[model samples]
Every structure is written in C-alpha cells, then in structure tokens.
Target: MSDRWQEMAVFVRVAESGSLSRAAREMELSQPSISRIINSLETRLGITLLLRTTRSVSLTDAGTVYLDRARNLLAEMEEAEQAARGVDSLHGVIRLAMPVVYGTRAVIPALATFMGRNPDLRVEIIITDARQNLIVDGVDVAIRLGVGQLDDSTFGARKLAVVERMVVAAPEYLLKHGTPTTPGELASHDCIIQQGAFGRESWRFVRNKTVTSVRVSARLWTNSGAGVTAAALAGLGIALATPLMAEDELRSGRLVRLLEPYQLPPAEVWAVFPAGPKPSAKVRAIVDHLAMSLGEKT
Candidate 1:
C-alpha cells in the first residue's frame, strides 16, 4: 500500500480546495499524482469518496464522514510534528469569522498584539453580521455574539465576553425630549430600533430579577448596529445598544444611558470551532488571546 499519510493529506487538500487542479497546485504536486493518490485511497478503502463533474467536485456521504475524521487525523499529525519541533514554532493560516462591529473595533486591535507574538502565522478575518457555516466556509474559528444558536455538535465553544445592552440617546436629543426614567415612559419617545440577525421588535428588560418585554415602535429602523449608533448620535432618537458599540460615546458624554434601573439582556460572545482531539496551535492562540482581551475589557 502507498503512504497512507500522503493519501490522507491529498484527500484533505482536494476536499478543501474543491477541485483537483486547485488542490494539486496548493500541494505543489502534479494533477495526475493528486488524482492517482485519491483513486488509490478510494480503491483500497472500497469506497467512492468524491463525486466529480465538469464544474465542481463534491463529497459523497461516506466522503463527508471520512473527511471529518481525516481532518482530525491530519490536525493531530500536524500537532505531533509541531510538538516535536516545539509548540512555539508551529505556524499556518487561521481563517476566522466575526461580526463586523466587533471585528473592526475589538478583534482587529487585539490581533495586532497576537500577530506581534506569532510572526509566522497569518490570519484571514471575514467580517459580517451573518453567521457562517464554519465547515462549508472553511473557517477555522468564529467569534459569535449572543448565545451561539448554530448547531455545533461537532464543535467546541469558549465564552469570550458578555456585552450588556444599554438604552442610549444623544445629549442633544435627551436635552430636547427629556430622558425616560422608566421602560413604560419610552412609549412617548422616538426610538431608533434594530431589525437584524438578532431579532425584530422584541426588546427585553429586567428589574429586580423580573423581566419584561417591550415592543417599541421605531421612528427610524436599521439593520446595521453602526447605522443605528450614527442615527442616535445625530440626535434622531433613543437607541438600545450594546456597551461595546457605544463605549466611546458613553465615555465622551456624546451619548447618555437612560432607564438605568431596568436592565437589558446581556449578549454573550463566544469563540467557536470544530471539535478535534487537538486544536491547531494558531486556533488555540487566537481564542485564548481574544478571551483574555475581552475578559479584561469586561
């Protein structure tokens, strides 16, 4: 039999690149050699692992199952090699996904320090509010806000931060309209509401451990957190926003918190990744760095 490790590596590369030619180019091997390795592996295992077409190649059912195990095995092998070389020397690309707001303000800043420490590693960060399917997107890890509702049976998660929601309004707006002391009084005020990935028209508040729900009518509605913050700062109306997003304004007194007695639900930020016997050194390093940075901020 041929080298099982070499065959497994080729299989993984093909699975990741989605085309034999691309995988061959990535692995620095000829197309025929890549094809021969995969075919030999499939023949030896008595399984057709991939479905190929002119346009694309996809994993068969067995291929999907085998792919997951193969990935874990490769990861373990890489870790073992790294261990032999000393864990500190290991390096590779780490693909990460994060919400746009947090990615810009928080994650990016923290990454500078991480990069300084790990010069051999490269990070590719995708910033968007939409949750990505990690395996399908080929993301190594993702920073997700709120409770991770994604189905992650084969993944692990680490809580990075907890963001408390606050009712905020521009100083000028509050000066003109007056601040509401109670949740009920918000009915009389113009509220800039958000309708996005989290939810629409559902605002929750808590007082003395008793929670209440409110459906505040929006004078201006937006799906972007940055947009909502901008509107509120321009004296449009009151906005319910997370402290992380409004920290600068709140500190500068550009925005003032209102209805302090009633509490909004705190969203938890988590670092999520595929479950494996041993996580890549780069993944663990980034996750740990984020958790530490966020924890300190919190």
Candidate 2:
C-alpha cells in the first residue's frame, strides 16, 4: 500500500478501536508499528490526530475531521473496486448494536431475511439496553428506540418507524384490580416500568388535543422491554409498551389494552450511525431492511 494510504487506514482503525493495542491486534501488526504509523501521519499532516494517554486514545479536533474524511475516502475506494469487479452483492461485516428486547422481537427477523439475501454479508449484533457510543464502540449502526433518545447531530439518523405506545395489562390483573377506565386510575394500579434509556417512568396520553400526563410507580422495574411484557403477562402489573412487544398476547386476549380513545404520542424507532460521511452501502441496506420490517411489524 502507499505510505499515505496505509497511515490513514491505521489511524482510522486506531480511532475506531479506541486503543493502539486493539488496532494492532486486528491489523496483525505490532503495537509499536501502529503507534509509528499514527505518529508518522500526524507528523506529515503537521497536526496531532490523537491525544494518547497511558490507557486511552482520543481524537483531536483535527483528528476527528480527518478520520471522518479518511473513513469515507477508504470506504468509497473499496466500493469502487467492488463496482469495477462487477460485484453487485453486499459483502463485508456490519457491527450493529440494538436494544436487547427490541432486537429479538423485531430486528432479528428482519436481519435474517437481509442476510439470507446477501450470502457474503456478515452481521455482528451487540444487544443491550444501555446507550451505545457508536464510534467508540466501533459499531457501524445502532437501533435506537423512543423519541428524543437521539438528540444530537453528531450522528446520522433515520426514522425507521413511529411506534405506537400502548398501555396494557393481563386480563387476570385487570380482573383482580379492576380495569382502569381512565389514565388517572393508573395511579392506583401497580405499573411495570422498563428502566434504562428508553424507560417510561411517566405515561402521557392525548385525546382531541387534550393532553394528560401521569406519573407511575412500579414495583417491577426491568431494563428489558421483554421483561416488562413478561411482567405484565404474569399479572404482576400494567406496562407501557409498543405493539412490537405484545402483539401475540394482545391478539390472544391475554393482555388487554387500556384507556381507549386516549392516543399517546407515538414513540419513534431510529437507525443511528456514526457522524460524518454517509453510511456505507452495507449499513444503509441493512438499515433500510430493518425499517421495512419494522413497518410491517407495526
């Protein structure tokens, strides 16, 4: 490889890995080699690309800008080579992050279909409820749930779907505690809360432009969306969830939707990616596939 090309690639890997050692291991180069390449690149550019401490590596302001452009340039180059070779199918690995429950319930099926169509493409999924730092985690994409969860312009975002928020309870629980006729009655009932970034500690409802906000207390606080659904199914408490979480149960009459005609503001599902540069073809394709699948699910 040309010296400039190799140096920029190394620097991008180091930044994505968040450490010299990790980048070195991935590239099958010695740590010293990785460091030397970064140093040489910085020296040639007349600007520091990284601020390295004993334990961590962070991008300088200029480094961030360069990483963005360099990554885009390299990606485009690879894609160009693929196009020239008449490789029309997707290839390469995509590291995707998603919420634990949401991934299982909604994303997996979509991903399965997408992967099936592209035999050469590989996907690595990291499922969790905690917020992911996409660039730092080396994640190509992350599926974010709820409105306002992705508030910054530091990343590219696509609205996959507007998920309807439903308040539901097991028939047993409702029968025992009496079904809530109004959103106000929820205060007297035990609610199931999904904790973490997408948690709803309070529920909001709207009817004919009238808005109602109700703060709820839950004896059961679980971080997973599936946990909330399981709790509601076990007759533990009422839960605020999406149709994606309770479709089967709701259809089976195991869980009953509460407070009719009070339309809650629809929450959103987003496919988020690192800031700067348009996402690669693989990332864009998978995100679009997920959006289509989620639309069908909803």
User: Considering every candidate listed, which one attains the maximal lDDT?
Assistant: 2
Clash count, predicted structure 2? 0
lDDT of 1 by residue, 85-151 (tens): 7767447677889887877988889888788877888787888877786755667788877633645
RMSD per model, one decimal:
3.4, 2.7
Model 2's lDDT to the true fold? 0.83
Candidate 2 residue lDDT tens string, 129-148: 87887766778888888756
> What value of lDDT does candidate 1 attain over all alpha carbons?
0.80
lDDT of 2 at 93: 70
> Model 2 segments beyond 4 Å from truth?
24-33, 251-254
